[model samples]
Target: MGRIAVIGAGMGSLATAARLAVQGHRVAVFERAETYGGAVGAFRRDGFAFDTGPALLHLPAVYRDLFVKTGKRPLEECVELVQVDPASRHLFPDGTDLALPNASRAGVISALDAAFGAGVGERWGDFLGRARVVWERTRRPLLEDTLREDTAPLGRDPYPALKRGLLRRAPATVAAVGERELRHPGLTALLSECVLSYGLDPRQAPPSAAVLPYMEQTFGSWYVRGGLRALADAVYERCEERGVEFRFGAEVTGVVEEDGRATGVELADGTRQEADVVVRGAPGEPLPGDLGRFVVLLALRGARPADAAHRTVVHGTDAPHDGSPDGPAPTVRVLRPDDDRLVPDAGHEAAVLSVTVPPQGAVDWRAPGYADAFADRVVAVAGAAIPGLAERLLWREVRTPADTERETGAPGGAVPAPALAGADGAWLRTANRGVPRGLYLVGGSAHPGGGLAHAGMSGAMVADLVAGGPGGSR
Candidate 1:
């Protein structure tokens, strides 16, 4: 058995470590932070808890398969997964409110029709049908397997464009698809927000970006019994169960190279840990113009309403739909999970409001009053969903891109979007291989790219390549 050194204790690296340990390899994980879960973190104060990262999980099978392969205990046994019914409620600028049921196409269609008048549902449904085609065409190449050496075919757009008139002009970007197909302002805004939520500019994102909504609507949204942090805890525990060693507060300064191949990692303390292979879980340089999340955690005085939807999206009137950065406000997503663990007591509630904005370099998140001013706008908008929000809010905590940078070591705290197959692979992430022999990239910045599920897939691909010996499948 060979020795493997993992650079970070993020989900992707933890998943890779567990799988490699089960495969009889000696694995050790080094994390710069004192705790695990790079971006998937939790905040606690005065008996209240909140997830600082992703609010929901989609395509849970990716992690389920990991747990099954690494141990006898499956993922469901590790943590309680609850499906979020009425998956999300959307409040459009035109005063249109709609609640979409979880994983039910018919229900979503009916909801759309009821909110936007007749025929709107069919149009949106038809668009998703086309999106499924994109999903089927790229799922294996993009998610299930390692990225190929020649990614030309995967670079081409797979969303079949409709034939308008005698000429068939394929929509290049997601915005074009919305303009030509959905046609309605509300529907277009909905599609734009879906892509924007992933930190991608919908105006420039490829049509294949549609796969995001397709995946969410198909697999449904889920929440862990505690928070997404619990899912991270479960994965970390599984790693420990597999005998994987972990060194917290151990920062990797560089990848040790010998004879043109990575041999191990050099630590911040000027020591080196040698191994047969090195896996880098830290994300690559943030993409130019990429976005980061601005979040506000609310401590409310009242109990969560029984009828409250787990998630709500309040679309902004000044959203940067055209890729301009000067918009007064961007779309905001409000999360109000019913889990009691998030609140201090039965009489109180916890809610998180998040919005996508330019990363740190583009905007100085540390500037006085910048974050709170933005938070005020967000709270005002979220008030549309949460009745008497101002009166209910007991206190608020704001987190910005600067905070994310300090926590994750990502420059500008720019979040990476999942790789898409279009615009000549402009959206594709770096390959898991080709970094250097004996070196592999596993995390949001590589292969299938970002998101909870895609990161897990990256781990699986790396493990597969390591097991296949030198010059493994690419």
Candidate 2:
């Protein structure tokens, strides 16, 4: 059996390690954090628990396949899947509230018809159909192909199948795509919300990403019984069964290369571990693209205004039993409120809000009193959306572009790898296989893009390549 050292014990790393161990390779996984699941983490304060990353599960088949291939029962048996009914509620300015049911294409169409008009649903169907095509055509090539082998230089460029399918026909901007598919402003705006959640804008986003909402609906958005972090723990459990070893609190400092090939890693703790292969599964900086907006997060103590959705507000409640101001604003505002009666603590109220600002260079927001400053900014830009939002806060926390960059290890805090808007942005994405041999990338960095499923697929594909297994380059 070959020896392998997998870096980072996030979902991607665990998946890679498990697959490699099942292949009879002696695999060891090193994680920088004290725990597994980089962003897929849970924190318990008092009686309430909060998931730090990934609230819903999309395309659960990806996880199920990983388990079945690794000699385990399907993921459904491992983790209880709860389909969120009404999927989600979208609030609009015109006092229109739309609840999207799980995979309810008809409902969504009907809602569009009621809100926009009769012809809108038909047009929506056409757009959704095209988006489904994008999913069908790109899923295997991008998500399932081993990045190392599939990306190996094939004399000339490969991935033409993926390139032609969604990348070419899609315009370079989210606005562009929306204009083409949607005639009504309201429907288009709703679609843009999806783009934002996926960390992109619909107009400039790669046509490939049009599949996101569809996948969520078709596969059905699921929540773990306890929390989203359970999914990470589930993957970790399977890895352990497969004999994958993990070292937490072991931060990777650098990749070690010799003779023009990756062979090992240097840890922040002053230790070097060698391996037959390595896969980078961490989030990465963004590729310069068409997105003109940047995000700032503000932590608050109360519920955001109901109409905050249209006025640049994203609400995450870490607290409860409180309220914030409401008004019109141009920037995105997020309100995360702490409710002690419902939540665990009385003194601990955590409210997270986000805003859209002009694209700027990275700046640090972790400095002293950064949270208060961020709250001030939120009130300033989205003040009309939340009147008197600032004075109501018990405490404030801010995550600036600089803070995200430093905290997430993403250059310029460019997580979600910038939006894959337009054909040019799509092509600019880095392939899994690097210029140097033996070096491969998984996680949110490589092709097919970010999100848990995409990262897991990247790791699995790279592992397949290392094992010379089926599903590598054909």
Candidate 3:
């Protein structure tokens, strides 16, 4: 068995390390942070806990498979996974409220119909039918296997275009699909927010973006009992069980390349660790269109409402689809999990509000009062979801992209979106192999891209390639 060195203790790297250790390879993980989980961070104060990263898990089977493959214990035994019913509640700009049932097509259709009037549900259902086709066509190359060198075929748009009178103009972007098919402003806004939440601008996202909603609606949303931080803890524990070594606060400076292959990594402290293979799990610098999340964590004095939906999205009026710095008030997502662990007691509640915003490069998140001013706007908007929000607010903690940069080491605090097929593969991430011999890329910045599920898949693919021997570099 060869020695393997994994850089960064992000979800992908942790998954890769455990799998590699099980395969009889000597694996070690080096992380710059004092702890693991990278962007999947947590904050605790006065007995209240909050997940600072992703609020929900979609396609949880990815992690389930990871646990099953790496050890005898399954994911359920490691962490409690609660399926969120009434998947999400949406409040549109026109005061239209719609609650989508979890993983139930018929129920979602009926709900959409009841809120948006008759026939609107059918339109969305039909759109999802097309999205399902996209999912089937790209599932293997995009998620199930390593990214191929020639991704030209995957680059082409796969969403079938509607025939319009003698001329069939295929929709190039996600916005085009919404305008040409869904037609209703509310439906369009819903679709836009779905893409925007992933940090992709709906206006420029590929039609393959349709698969996002399909994946969510089909697999359903899940939450860990404590917070997403608990999921990270489970993965880290699994890595330890597999005999993987971990060195925290070890910053990798550069890959040590010799004879056209990665021998190991050089650390910031002037130490060099040699290994047979090097896996880079750190995210690359933020791209031009990359975006960051601004979160407002509210500690309320009263208990969570009995009728509160686990997730609520309040759509903004101006530039709802655009995630640029100059865009209008951003659409905000409010999360109020029913888990008691998040609150100090039944009398107190924790609510988190998040929105997509320009990365640190586009705007200075640290400029005095910038975070508070933006947070004020977000809280004012969230009042629509929480009854008597101002009166109930006990204290609020604001987190900006600047904080993300400091915590996660992602430049500009920008988050990477999942890979999409279309627009000539503009959205596809870097391949897992072929960059350099003995080196593999895993994480949100690499193949299959971001999201908890995609990160797990990237780890699996990287492990498979490593097991294939040196030729795997091809």
Candidate 2 Cα deviation (angstroms), residue 244: 1.6
Write down the RMSD of all candidates, one decimal each: 2.2, 6.9, 2.3
Candidate 1 has an lDDT of 0.87
Q: TM-scores, in order shown?
A: 0.96, 0.76, 0.96
lDDT of candidate 3 over 59-167, digit per residue (tens): 8989988998989999999999999998999998778899999999899999999999999999999999999999999888888888887899998988886755556
**lDDT value, residue 157 of candidate 3:** 86
Rank order (by lDDT, best first): 3, 1, 2
Q: Candidate 3: misplaced stretches above 4 Å?
A: 165-167, 317-327, 469-474
Candidate 3: residue 39 lDDT (0-100)? 95
Tens digits of lDDT, candidate 1, 184-267: 988898888888889888878888999999999999999998999999999999999999999999999999888988899999
Query: What's the CA error at residue 437 for candidate 1, in Å?
Result: 0.8
Pairs that collide in candidate 3 are none
* CA shift of 442, model 2, Å: 1.5
10 residues in a row with least lDDT, candidate 1? 317-326
Error of 3 at 58 (Å): 0.8
